[model samples]
Target chain A: MAPRNKYSVILPTYNERKNLPIIVWLLNDSFTKNGFEYEIIIVDDASPDNTAEIARQLQTAFPNRIILKQRSGKLGLGTAYVHGLQFATGNFVIIMDADFSHHPKFIPDMIRVQSTKDYDIVTGTRYSGKHGGVYGWDLKRKLVSKGANIFADTVLRPGVSDLTGSFRLYKKDVLEKVITKVQSKGYVFQMELMVLAKAMGYSVAEVPISFVDRVYGESKLGSSEIAEYATGVLSLWMRV
Target chain B: MTRAQQTVSIGLLFASTQLYLALFLQLIPLPSIISEEIIPVLPLWALVSFGSYLLAKLGYGVLTFNDVPEAHAELMKEIDLAREDLRTKGVEVD
Candidate 1:
């Protein structure tokens, strides 16, 4: 068997005190179960809820496995990953939400796909195979997600099934290259990353993943974010 | 596009086809059931097909177009275990 590649998960959290512990535990469990070497870097942007404190406790429990990288204020999502990248020691970097929505169980499959195919990136999609789709979302939310994906696909034709999905694995160097090229922040960051990747001719693969609603905190999505996402999509269409 | 979305889109296309067919038959002055029963049934067919389309998007098991897979339940269990592990470590959880 080929030696396992070290996987570093850069989880960005903001006011996720209650969710921090469980997600870390699940990450630990999933990595151990798959017999893969992994590290989780918790990048908290000074959440007032003291999510950093809980992350600190998790670091103590997990010892060297969990690393906490703290920022002074709430920065954008794109920057959080970039900050976490400085601390990632693994050859592969996994970017996911601190919320429970993106399950860690699919991490092994992503790693396996990357190893076998030598793809530059592998994204977890909710629109792929039998095991894919969203749960705990109402019709409105579903429509919004589907609509955003369709609008982007019609304009950019990125060719990937799920353009807005955040759960993805990237080779360290490839991520570093593409991250620098992406200019969007907030909700559009994930979409822009994939668009840039496709435009740059990077090999991308999709793994079916089931997305669940957050079990703890309130969702950050709102009307303003949706409006911004639409504008962002249009802007990206013109530029890319 | 998802299977559920495709199902709904295709359903709408079928409804439109029926509507156009009925209109065309009416222009040709067909004396068959096409002018009476089939034309009236066109709207009813559209309504029923659209209703079924919504049901499919909602993951109604009868249609089985986009039902949430069983793997979710298992993943939820794993999450629960992770929570339990955290609680055992003396973290206060509700």
Candidate 2:
């Protein structure tokens, strides 16, 4: 018997108080509108701001649809997903940015793609076809992101259109398998997931998505992160 | 400019600036030991860096290229069909 499809959205947030309410609302609206049985697992890594407080209030408004998993401190992105996955009751899992960079409107597209075939993963790409693009970015920022993609693409050859995109849907089992194989946290974690999925022969689907820059808070891509991403790709190349 | 173009130009600009500085220092005739030791090493450093970059690129390309062509093809087909289905339903995939 085929199991019913249920979606678990894991949103790893830190200092996202202002963005949390809107993101949650959007997620709830999109999922309910599409008639998808879904639960949003928000893992807040002890944000110094009122992010968790906002999430708790959202939980009241939505009840069973919103699950808050608060940690003690600012954990890394990779671990946050892992932590959120523990409470996920769905057969499929979603990992996305809570900063409004990844809109909930694209969730339906991801679901539609996954439904046509039993793809192990459906990734949102900002570099595929006419439908994909990045908006609200300066030239330097855009160049850096593009260069990183090319560098990773040229080296890792992940084959997917967007290796660094956080917006993606994965069959729960497939995500569990790939997540264990990836050693990176933070920015490199997304890139490694695609590389590992392909290496493991899991089918990956891409949906064109418009990636908008964050409207709130400071951008997290600092010099240290770029350095980390480069070294991480090199290490993955050497090992994987 | 596209990100790819900007990246390439920036790389070229950095390389040219380094070359100009090296040539300028040579023209000013610094102490022979400092200039000579550094000059020989500069080219070697550039060569090593470029070589490593190429090797990493080629190595990754060779290692991961077409490793799962069949899987990729199947996945792409699924994505295309799904996109068409959604477009018919009036969902903006972009």
Candidate 3:
């Protein structure tokens, strides 16, 4: 028999009190329905809204299924993943947004794709396949996203359709290896991970997913973040 | 090699080949029109075509970008169900 696989979802959050409960509930529903052995690791970086407290309440409700790792200050996303990784015991690790932008329903598809050839990483994409696309974004938002993706594809040529999408399932070993090589901190982090994984000769597969923008919190993509993303892509082009 | 190195190497090779072709055209007495008119502005033409292609691709992508209202509506219902289930399970939800 194939070895039983466990998936640990590392959800990094800040001030996501309102969305946390619903996302957790949906995750539980998805996992239960799929009959997958999984655990959720909530790595909360001290949100004033008491997101961690809600996570603690969730731990009570879900018992061993929920693992809450609270950090002191509002750290960056990369560090949050690193912190969450330390607590993940599953053979496969999933990294996704806690804001409900990346739904849990697609996790099953990602797993199925990963199993076909045992891809080292299975990433959810919004730009390829029939079911792939985004909702709740305006024309300008779509333009920016498409432009960023084209720019990255031109420069880095990572071969994956969606470079910025954060919904992904990585074999624990591949994720650990790739994360150690990743140096970018913010918006560039996801792109950098994909590029570095390709550089390290890891097999990657894509699954189509509908990315619904945040339901509760504000989704911020400021000019400064765009500038940062541009520079980040250029730097990866030079180094990777 | 890194992507940067590969790109640079390929670009340099292409530029040199174009330069050699242009020089050969000038030396070999081909039609003056072909040599002077087309060869000189070939890179510019390539650039313009590539730029247009990228623009059209981006435009088509933006035009066809899906807006799934049904997903949004379904999620709202899911949220209500989740909230009710959480409350029933003795979990306090705000």
Candidate 4:
């Protein structure tokens, strides 16, 4: 028989107190309905909202399935993943937002796509397929996102539709290898991870997903982030 | 080779080849249509066309970007369900 696979979802949160419980519940529902062995690794970076308290409550509710890793202060997102990965016991690792922007309903679809071709990484994209889209984003936001994607696609030619999307499933080994090579710390981290993964010749498959903007919190994409992303793309173009 | 290096090298090769072709056409007295009109502005035309294509693609993407209101509605319902279920299961969810 094929070896049983477990999915460890690493959710990095700063102040996701309100959304955490619902997202976790949805994740549990999705996993249980699909009958997949999974564990949730919540890496709370000292969310001042006392997000860890809610995580502890969740541990009581679910027991043994929720792994909470609390950090001292607000480190960068890249380090948050690195911290969470150390606790992940599953062979497959999924990284996504705790703000409900990346719904857990699509996890099964990603898994199905991965199984079909054994893709090294499966990413949820909002740029491909008829069903893929975003909710609650204004025209300016849409333009910026589309323009950024086009700019990166033109320069890097990474062959991936969504370069900045964070919702992704990776073979545990592939993720560990790729994460080590990634150097960016902020918003560019997501883009760098995908580009470097492609450079490393890992096969990637895309799944169209509806990315609803964060329900409970503000989504940040400022001018500095955009400038960093532009430079990051150019640097990756030259390096990779 | 890196993508930047490959692009620059290929671009230089193409530009030099075009220049050589232009010089050869002038020396050989080829057809004016092939040598003067087309050869002189070939790169310009290509650049403009590529730019236009990119612009059109971006515009199309923006216009057709999916909204998915149903997803948000469904999620609200799911949040309610999740809260109820968690509360019943002895998890205090705010």
Candidate 5:
């Protein structure tokens, strides 16, 4: 049997100063209720809003579980995780958002599904089940998201419903291999990871999850991100 | 895309229009109401195309270049300058 070790949560945050405490509390409650030993590694990209300072305060509160790895600047979303993964001690890693878009309650389910399937990775899918849906985004925002996923599906054919979704659980070794192969670091970074995983013959499964919009601060996604997505999509399309 | 990008694209379209006009202006010699009355905007289309091509190159350069190192170096220089100023004022920084 494979080793069942501590779970490390690598959360990449930027200007999520408001949601830090609540997200930490929610993770603590979820992990405590599930009786799992875990670590929350806050990977901040030197947010101007003092997100790293808040992470330090959270470290003082949780001591052992919460850790801070402040980056020099906003390099990219994908690189932030790569930076955090270097210091992650657990055999399994959970990567998610700090903006409350990814609820902590779904984590236990993701772990359970992975265990049943003996999967190397388990990602949350918003379009898989009846209950899973995005809340608090306008119709135009929803269309752009759906179109991106659809465009990816039509091209990459990664066999995953939600390639653009960031919330995922990965075996440390599997993540290590996948990250090494993923080159795109823009909006389609998540999509590239899954596509690369499939190319490498990794076992991946998805658990249904309901995604909620951010509760505080502004969303990082803008028109520029959409254009980046287009570039990333075409780049992958040509590669595959 | 910014205002410059839009202007370049419009200019490119105008360039193709001018090439068309330069070709059509010599043939048929249509009535004044059909061809001669229109604003003579097509001749500048070649310039528009050149401008658009340059703009496209600029856009590509912006996308492909990474400014992190330059930015980091700039920040370091500013920090050094500030440290010098502080030292002159007898301000200690740890």
Candidate 6:
């Protein structure tokens, strides 16, 4: 077998017990088949559910590949990435959803793009190119998602078409630098990281990926998240 | 801007208005010294207003976006715990 690339996947999951197992299986299939030495780092923010226990079991199942980094309390999403980064031991880092929205299937394409172009970052775009798509969201949901991205782009001019995508792969050092510079704590944190990345003139590549909605459970996103997203985008634009 | 600077902006606006009033009243030869001193307050007022705008943005950020002090405090606590754990294992946390 060819030497596998050490790809540390940092997954931030909050109350996602139901989705955890499936995500793990998918990630395992993707990396194992592709001959990649990967580690799954699940940062659980003291979720009220059994997410931590499930993560422990997955670690037991995968042993060397799945690493459970449990936190004491429910911290925000942005801080979770910072927490997970302390333990990420990979040449490249992958950030994505455990809710099944960011499919593991697109990850190979992302890796291929990065390898071919030698880009600093390869991000999944839902609305940018010809091939990207979104599933399971209603028309209104789509509009809200689209509008939020447009709003951030207009204010900060991040230059990336999809400024709010969470599925991305970064050079480990680049991820560290960008995560340190980013200050957003909630949903808008996703958008702000890209904005900061753009401001710092990082070379980025976009790959079209169909973002599927979670098959199980309700979405963690809501109107309140949107308000926080708006507030965060505005603050980052001014602060940075 | 500092609190003092914000007040200075309003004070400047007030003084500018007061100088105009003084000049109008001086047509009948009333006290005019107060107007000269107050008129110069205009620059201070403008300066204060600009400072206030920056302050307002800072205040908004502190309220809505990032809490630097809180995050730092939490980070320090985490470090302390990690250090203690390392000490138990005869390993330095550095």
Top candidate by DockQ = 4
> What TM-score, over all chains together, does every model reach?
0.78, 0.71, 0.94, 0.93, 0.69, 0.68
Clashing pairs in 2: none
lDDT of 2 by residue, A15-66 (tens): 8876666667668778888888999999999999768877776766677898
lDDT of 6 by residue, B19-81 (tens): 666665554354556556654475688899976865564444223321123333433454455
Model-by-model DockQ, in order: 0.15, 0.03, 0.64, 0.70, 0.02, 0.02
TM-score of 5: 0.69
Candidate 5 regions exceeding 4 Å error are A1-3, A220-223, B1-94
Q: Name the DockQ score for candidate 4.
A: 0.70
C-alpha lDDT (0 to 100) for residue B80 of candidate 5: 56
Residue-level lDDT of model 4, residues B1-94, one tens digit each, is 4789889999999998877676656975778777877767877888999999999989998998888898899989999999999998777677
lDDT of 6 at B48: 97
Specify the poorest-scoring 10-residue window by lDDT in model 1 chain A: A212-221
Indicate which candidate wins on TM-score: 3
iRMSD for each candidate structure, in the order shown? 5.7, 13.7, 1.5, 1.4, 18.8, 18.2
For residues A77-188, write the lDDT of model 5, one tens digit per residue: 8898899999999989998988777778789998899889779999998775654666666656666676677667766778898889989999999999889878888667
Off by over 4 Å in 1: A1-3, B1-65, B69-72, B90-94
Tell how far residue A235 is off in model 4, in angstroms. Answer: 1.3
lDDT tens digits, residue span A1-240, model 1: 876689999999888887778888888888999899999998989999888888877877788998898999998789999999999999999999888788898999999888788999999988767878877777667766776676677678899988999999999999999999888998899999999888888999999988877766567668898899999999998887
Interface RMS deviation of candidate 6: 18.2
Q: Which ten residues in a row have the lowest lDDT in candidate 5 chain A?
A: A130-139
- Residues B1-94 of candidate 1 have per-residue lDDT tens digits of 3579779999999997876775756865766677777765777898999767655544442233244646568766876787788777766444
Which pairs clash (backbone N, Cα, C closer than 3 Å) in model 5?
A: B15-B45
Instruction: Give DockQ: model 5.
Output: 0.02
What docking grade does candidate 2 earn?
Answer: incorrect
